[model samples]
Target: MFSKSCNYAIKATIFIAQQSLQENKVSFVDIAKEIDSPTAFTAKILQILVKAGIIESVKGVNGGFYIPKRKIKKTFLVQIVDAIDGDSVFQGCGLGLSHCSEKHPCPVHDKFKSIRNQLAYMLKTTNLEELALGIKSGETFLKTL
Candidate 1:
């Protein structure tokens, strides 16, 4: 459903949002560990998120990453997906074909459209704050272990 980078971006953003709610900053190492992603790969994803204004990067001895308080509630999962994976998740073919459309439909095109619409709705409606709270309260988790 999402690329590895997008998955990490969502996890990292949720983790950062939780820290932001606590008025704390999170290091790349902490984010990588929490998300169960490689540090280098997580750093690359964070760079994208920072550039997209999804998260902030502080540069100092005590610096780390955190989402602005204003953004935590306003930022949608769709925005993070757009920043990391573009509109491909919403627009791309169900079978990964370059040109599968209604005119030239794939085997599962119609069925997939419904699923894609549901996913889009979910992404558009789910914001970072709610997801962060789920993690903060231990009702959900970013990593299996």
Candidate 2:
């Protein structure tokens, strides 16, 4: 499971992606509302994403958060997760051990390995444009009804 910050980051990223097609930028308040996330927490997450170069921010009357044209090609879900929550979620032991490895496997190590690999693949391969298109085409749903 992802942490609250990760969840918010994903939501904010998707919202920005969806809006990118229509607008070059969006306000933090707008993103928070669209994702139903807390404004303060979402702001912090957005800052982290910006710092990670997963998202871009500008300051001015018309300035706000937006995905950089260049980053749209290089950034992936894993980077965002790493920026906000660190790599432990993806690399840590599945059974919450202090240390886990092939020689010291956890109870669910084998079972979790396949699933974890698949998730890593998806995160590494998927980018904001692909996710944005999914949102626009209804292939993905961002908000809960």
Best by the lDDT measure: 1
Query: Where in model 2 is the C-alpha error above 4 Å?
Result: none
Name the weakest run of 10 consecutive residues (lDDT summed) in model 1: 136-145
The Cα error of candidate 2 at residue 36, in Å, is: 1.0
Residue 45 displacement in candidate 2 (angstroms) = 0.6
Worst 10 residues of 2 by lDDT: 67-76
Q: Which residue pairs does candidate 1 place in steric collision?
A: none
lDDT of 2 at 139: 84
Report the lDDT of model 1 for residue 39: 97
Q: Which residue pairs in candidate 2 collide?
A: none
lDDT of 2 by residue, 1-145 (tens): 6898898898799779777766779999999998999899889899888877788888999999987665665668888878878876677788888788889899999888888888889989988878887888998888889
* lDDT of all predictions: 0.94, 0.84
